[model samples]
Target: MKKIFVVALGIMLCTGISNLQAQNDNSETPNFSKLDASPMDLALYRNQENEPMARIIYSRPQKREREVFGKLVPYGEVWRTGANEATELTLYEDMKVAGETVPKGTYTLYTIPEEKEWTVILNKKTHTWGAYEYASEEDFVRINVPVRKAPNNIEALSMAFEQVEDGANLLIGWDDRYIKVPFKESM
Candidate 1:
């Protein structure tokens, strides 16, 4: 009886340990940092009452002297729009994205980069690792934005929301290139 009890306890302990390991498996590296190794960043825009109106969470990959468009990211393809996990966009209120109305919700952001223009894609899928499994049919809206050259080179990828007259323009920038996607509160 004592031997059987001991064996069962050992099995339970191993199973518990396995569950804990699985929980910790998916996460950022324990501890890593450097300029070339830009980590994940979160950008949030708030209203006058300090309520978050919009939020973006994405990873920034450094230039590292590599060609950004048509090479590393590959033009005419659906890029994750950032490093690591798929970029996330959360809206607190209904808004007009490039003339199309989008209700307040969280969505994944993707892009198809081109020399003259870039197509900004907002999809309903969230919590994705990358754009590897992106589906165009799942897209909420595709906004065509003109690409513009940056005055100076940017090493790390970046996204910012600048306050516009009524809402904000989401600025996506990297490697001397950028595009702005305007979003206005729905009337």
Candidate 2:
């Protein structure tokens, strides 16, 4: 009985060590940001409102001297919009994005890059790791926005919400091109 107990103890220790080694081998540091768009635009611009109406969470990836638009990201292909996990957009209230009504909720953001235009898609699926699981049939809204010329190169993928006359503009930029998706607050 004592021999069997000793063998079991040794096995447990070996398994624990193996687990520790595996963890160490895969140890990685990922910087994530809970980008609050509500305070940036909704709170500051809309004086009558006290709550944040929209937000996004995503990881930033830098361009290390590589071709971005047509090559690295590949034009005409769906991009996850950021690094690591899929970029998420959270809306606290209903809004009209490029004439399509988007109900208030969390959504996975995706984009298809083109030379002169871009397709922005809002999917019902949330917490997706990447665009690998993206399905066109599941798209809530596929809005085509014109690509604008940026003055300077943007090293990282970024989205900025700016106040517009009727509502707000979600500007996505990377490298030297950008696109603005206008949205109006509803409900």
Candidate 3:
């Protein structure tokens, strides 16, 4: 009778341990490659009739938390706007930002963040990793924009469009900071 009780207790412990291991393995990070890739489109400006004036299509990587905004990202420095591959910003039509007119083209996007403002960059180079290899000679346009505090914190960086009377605000928000790039449609 004693031997049978001991065997049953051992079997129950082994089963419980196996079940816990299965739960941990199931919560592991998902393989993004196996998932279908969906790129998002962000419209920048609006016409007099409330139509989209310019659009930017981009794909964000799955991983986060590396040296963003301090070490890997570096404080008071330029970032390549995204991870893994270069962050691509496509201009479907001419638009104006900070008094500069940008023609329709695909450009690599970068940013320099301060506590109160951010400098948005449009570089001629389109494909690269982080800004570790960035060159000022490749810059096509640079514009300074004010940063606004977000009511709710965003874990990941996100961009969206907000309608205005004469144009649209291309808003980029992340980590409690928000920046609005005012884009006016070209007449």
User: Which is the leading candidate under lDDT?
Assistant: 1
Task: Please list the Cα RMSD from the true structure of every candidate, rounded to 1 decimal place.
Answer: 10.2, 10.3, 7.0
Model 1's number of clashes is: 0
| Model 3: number of backbone collisions | 2
Tens digits of per-residue lDDT, candidate 1, 1-187, equal: 9999999999999999988887677573364445546589988877656777899999999899999899999989999999889999999999889889999999999999999999999999889988888998899999899999989998999989988877889999999999999988777
Q: What's the lDDT of the predicted structure labeled candidate 3?
A: 0.70
Show model 1 residue runs off by greater than 4 Å.
1-36
TM-score winner: 1
Query: Which order, best to worst by lDDT?
Result: 1, 2, 3
lDDT of each: 0.90, 0.79, 0.70
Model 2 over residues 12-85: C-alpha lDDT tens digits? Answer: 99999988877667345344568733112111223135466677777767776889889888899999887778
Worst 10 residues of 3 by lDDT: 35-44
- In model 3, where do residues sit more than 4 Å from their true spots? 1-32, 35-52, 59-68
* Candidate 2 wrong stretches, greater than 4 Å: 1-50
> Measured by TM-score, how close is model 3 to the native structure?
0.68
lDDT of 3 by residue, 70-175 (tens): 5544558887665556667776677776777888888787888877778888888877776776788998888888878789866666777787766677787766
Quote each prediction's TM-score: 0.79, 0.73, 0.68
